[model samples]
Target: MFIVFLKFSENKSLASQFMDGHNQWIKQGFDEEVFLLAGSLQPNLGGSIIAHNTTLVELQNRVNEDPFVKESVVTAEVFEISPKKADARLNFLVGA
Candidate 1:
């Protein structure tokens, strides 16, 4: 799994201009089953995505194509994690 963090950049003002494209990119991730979850940051300063079903390199490649990255509206950092355990309800995260 991966935790992708998007930090609002100084160019955040340009976000509105690229939102449509960004949303399309997000939809593509979901359609391809690369993203498991996505939502805003606690302070609304940025956002984060929980992704799976993709390799780190592939995820990085995809992120590079994001409108936010292209227009410098946000800076992204990815953290890769290996799921070892999960509660029964979410046990699927730790493959059998």
Candidate 2:
């Protein structure tokens, strides 16, 4: 599994301009079953995504394609996680 943080950058103002494309990128992730969750960061700092079913290099390439990242509206940091255990409902994550 992986956690992707998209923190606002100096060019955060450009966010609105690329929001449509960014949203589309997010939609694509879900459509492909790569993203398990996505939401806003606390205090509006930025956004985050919990993802799986992909390798780190592939995830990095995917993140690079986000309009927010490509246009410098945000900086993306991807953290990989080795899941050893999970709640029963989320046991699928253990193999990620």
Off by over 4 Å in 2: none
Roughly what TM-score does model 2 have, to 2 decimal places?
0.98
Model 1 C-alpha lDDT per residue in residues 1-96, reported as the tens digit of each score:
899999999999999999999999999999999999999997878889999888899999999899999899999999998888888886767752
What TM-score does each of the candidates earn? 0.94, 0.98
Q: What TM-score number comes out for model 1?
A: 0.94
Global lDDT of each candidate:
0.91, 0.96
Best by lDDT: 2
Q: Which ten residues in a row have the lowest lDDT in candidate 2?
A: 87-96
lDDT of 1 at 94: 79
RMSD of each: 1.3, 0.5
Q: Candidate 1, residue 44: CA error in Å? A: 1.7
